[model samples]
Target: MNRKDKIALERYRKRLEFARSSGEVNAFETKAEQKARIERAKKDYAYMCKEYFPHYATSEPADCHLKAAKQTMKNPTIKKFDEMPRGFGKSVMDDILIPFWLWINDQAHYMVLVTVSKDRASELLEDLRAEFEGNPKIIHDFGEQHGHGQWEKGFFITKSGFVAKALGAGQSVRGLRVKSRRPDYIVVDDLETKELIKNPKRQDEYVKWIERDLIPTMDGDIRRFVYANNRFAPVMIQTKLQEKHPEWVVNHIKAYDPVTYKPTWHQKYHDNYYRELEKDIGTLALEAEYLQNPQVEGYYFKPEHIQYGKMPKLNQFKIIIGTWDVAYAGSATSDYNAIDVKGLHDKNFWVIDTFVKRCKMVTAVSYMCDFQKRLPKTVVVHWRFEAQFWNDEVERVIRETERQYGIKLNILKIQVPKIKKMDRILTLHPYYQNGRIFYNEKLKSHNDTQVGIAQLLSIEPNYKTNDDYPDTQQTGIALLEPYNTQNDGLNYRQGKMRPKNERI
Candidate 1:
């Protein structure tokens, strides 16, 4: 045997050894049983996957998403894009499970996996290589897969005319074919990166390559195209494809409900898992990666507009007011209970404290009571919330909170004018633009403070982004306009009329 044959023999030996020892192959099934099982699995993809990969399909019964994805792959003529979130077993599903299914079903003659880089794709291809080289159950069912003993890292050909190749993004796609067949199954996994999304020219070029070059390499009428990646950026390849091919099947499954935090794949993951993950990575990252709803950096309220400094003493301010934006449903799908405590001094609006969260009205009310208790009773803070949100439930919540805390809250209602919400939000544009708004430098790293700022910067004219934090912020600052001058004492009230000067 040649040196290449010797190497192939050695690789196969090690792979088979691992597979047998690792419970990846069945040692008990007779030939008839294996044949019957494979034949039954030829139609039941999920069963086939579970039986073949008991360790991977360990959710007792697999999640609906896994079953659904398998059904999608079963279609020979499928053209689909899946914006699957992280931790959803995307790599394993596309690289190993689907490829094996296609090869066993004779649906693919030549398969191609195009990832961010050649090396990464080659590394991913190893999983499939191990399955083909060693899986005893597969070998018993369909015979040996190592065809012609030509197993290379870049591409591999099995004994049963199955061909699999790996390539990098923007790689040359001039000649991709088997002896007489073109690629029948193509998987494009994570071709966009953070830096790549920032460069529109490169993004455009990559899309062109996929459309004008790579995809056209498929020759058969019966084929499948799966682009599996989260749409974490505005100009990513997956986003472009989704816009261009609205007719294609799109499975944009998120890890959990962004509002309720209920796990989508509950069989595999739990609610606390997503909550803990969000805490570790922060809300913005959770939205971008696991939710696939990335927030673009502020266009109107740029980062430069945000200023932070050491705040003056609470008593030194001309006026300190608190604004509350009440929300009925305390989920991200609805408005949050956004409250911003603002103090106007020297014509600058300083964010002293913030309470932004998606919780029940009682929780926000309790927070107000707690904050009131923490402050010096000598320094009074007049609080106001929109009159439109005032209802029996709101009143009951306030009364209950007051009773529970055994203290009265100095709060009132502010009639929101009949103007557009966005119009009202734009009231703070001048302050932000003129560098008259300052965040408490000490509280800059606070989660509530950061979330409020993120929402402020993400505001757009007509787009429905989260505006709860900024809504309350503008309301508080706008209310403190008359108090910009330091003539009023610390006792100035919200609706207290100014004492008219009398002729002496």
Candidate 2:
């Protein structure tokens, strides 16, 4: 069918369904039962959420969600900014449940929903509209809710005299009112996009807009201004607000603890699920979206530092080592298995190949074994990973691969240095800066190589995201340490050694 027909059909069906809803009287809860429910909902936001929208609020609310709800509801004059991990239903709680909760309790007479754009705001408004117009529980509890204003575009008013308007960022929002009751409750959701974060001027403009224009639109002594979004970058509006207004209630919560790799909502997220997600979306994205730590851009290390050129002959290399940086978790930690095969010649470190992936131990072990088989029998490779990661799991994977391939790898555990990771990764900067490191030009476009290079370039002091690639590369250089030393032939700075006794 055409677009108009489909839309008309949808509207007609909604009307028919609304007409049929009364016949589903058996499905509706009794007035007293609903009254009791409303009382309970007034007291607890989470309960109202699950009871009203069973389809959306599937699992028990996480502490972050509950905390956000409490913070939003407890203070009527709250100017709160919540930074929740994406996919954790920040919108459902901030935009819909809490606002509806206030309306139901007669706490808010006018509400405003602001998003990144007017269209986006309208979409969220539609969700609230769906609950009002079609939700049986809402209809049963609050009589009918749709009416009082044009539900066109981005404006709506319930029959019970609650006003709501959706607006985009940077739009004029001063002097908004509904019969002497201006917007007492305002929610700003997903106002920072990836593009907006890149422009510092734009980010500053947004923060300015919120502080100067949008928040001023609300009336009365008791006003609610909520800004909810998962921080997408280091210098977004949320961070700007955090710096300027430390007094505002800032509820910053990640989907999982970065150190323990524990999910905030333990009942919903698990290790296996995160593993698949890490594989599907990559570590950088997971760190940003799920872990609330966006990837750090390189300050010391630059892309130009990595030179792609012709590799020297293998026979010309003084020493070769295939270094591995292993993580304990199969998929949980912000660690990937990085296998960097490197060679040193004439003070230059040549990165021959790389195997970087967030995968099972068996997969990384299999790659090591396969790569070993491809090398000529004359070439000997010294395989090494950190001695700290020497465990039954790593041993079992290597032994099983040995059995499968009928070939033993000359793998050994290397002692980890007492130095910090950030310091060690930075040690490679001089080599890169001096034009002494050559990446195999043929592997320049390879996924593993590119990913490894990206990590290398992302190195800076106290970087929180993955660093396994550069860690392995630096370890490989350490392994070839013996090849790097030079003998200084008899330079006579001590020709004065005899002069010391003479001077005395």
Candidate 3:
């Protein structure tokens, strides 16, 4: 069938179904019933939205949040932010529907839509053009448009004197004007990317532009701003904007209902559907994308979010080493002496064993000696410790422990610079995100491992707790990096200096 025939059939089916459900024909409808429907549509923004764009909205909920958004946008002094998950019609609402509605109602005459790239911004404008040209519902309600000659890719001028323009981030938006009108509303959509946020300097630059350039382009104090994005990172531009200006009203719509693990909008993304996606992408990525939790905060070590499973056998490991974060006295309040037996098999970084203690120096040395003696006979375990924390007395104890244990400890004293503790722990965060870190299942039972897990989960900037486990794990991972590129399996080479130095 042709498109027109199909549309006719679909409408006929809907009408017939409605008649059967209500036990009444539309031809016999009461005047009161028709009046109520008309009055309700006039009052409801979501109702009006669907009435205008019925084809784009299927399984329409009672509330699509357009009503609330419209009310919020009515207050010009209120800067608005809506963080909706992917595929939730964020662009349709912010880039097209809200702006178009505001324009037709004479709420605003000039609007700007900014995105990550100029091409994306232009495409958003093209959507508006398509709607204006061909949307029968809009044309029937608002009359035919007379802006055909003025419509273009990046900017358009409606015959009613409403102007819409598209611009990318970092582009010059100063003194933006069309005739005597300046932008009355600005809609920023996903202006951040992983690449853009990676550099601290670049992030600051973007923020400066948003504050110094974008906001100032408005004609008066009664300008409305709408920012739409998913919660990609805690340091994202929207997050920063909210921090600087606490008055901004922010709304975050998560894809899934956290308690039920079901999709919030089941018609689009169902529970079982996203559970499969969660499995494929892993929990960390899924949480960031759908749950609106990036698992990144001030303290970067997220041990709770780290992927863990049964580790391979000791023999299967290509490299195994016990790396240390040493303390001198190990007093009750002093830093705990810590060591982690770490190994690498395939792409997985494994923490096979952990030892952390608040005891005398001799006791700490004994734990290290015992850890060396317990390793597999076939495994040539390399030993590394912070040399700055050791002295002639500690070195003498290590030599005697080797003689007594009859095990040659391939020990290396790494003189690492005094870096800030928090910075050191965060170096492992990327590996955790990539699902590369695993811990021995039994390690959870040990107090030191428990301490490590606690620190990992609760870590933040200016972390107050002892981070012995995370610090030692960092050392162990650093030692394993050299072998990460080699193909001939675990090669025992001299340990190199750690890559990043912490600020003292």
Who wins the TM-score comparison?
Answer: 1
Question: Residue pairs in steric clash, candidate 1?
Answer: 147-159
lDDT for each residue of candidate 2 in 72-191, tens digit (9 for 90 to 100): 778989998888887788887877788888888888788789888887887677667666777777777788887845555468788888787888889987647766778899899988
lDDT tens digits by residue: candidate 3, 1-504: 999768645654553343223122255557787566555555566675666656555556424466445655568655888888776887777877677666655677788989988778876666666666556555544566648667766787766677888899999986578767899889898888887767778888888899999988886755988898888775778888888989788887777654346677776666687768765775556656876756443355554555557879998988998887777765435676778888989866898887776655566667767876776787667888887767888788778877877766767888665887677677777677655678888765555665556556657765555678778888889888767764334332212222233222
Name the best candidate (by lDDT).
1
C-alpha TM-score for every candidate: 0.85, 0.71, 0.57
lDDT of each: 0.78, 0.78, 0.71
If ranked by TM-score, best first, what sequence of candidates would result? 1, 2, 3
State model 3's lDDT.
0.71
Following a full C-alpha superposition, what root-mean-square deviation does model 3 have from the true structure?
13.5
After the best TM-score superposition of candidate 2, give how far the Cα of residue 43 lies from its true spot, in angstroms: 2.4
Arrange candidates, best lDDT first: 1, 2, 3
Query: Which candidate, 1 or 2, would have the higher lDDT against the true structure?
Result: 1
TM-score of 2: 0.71
**Model 2: per-residue Cα lDDT at residue 400:** 93
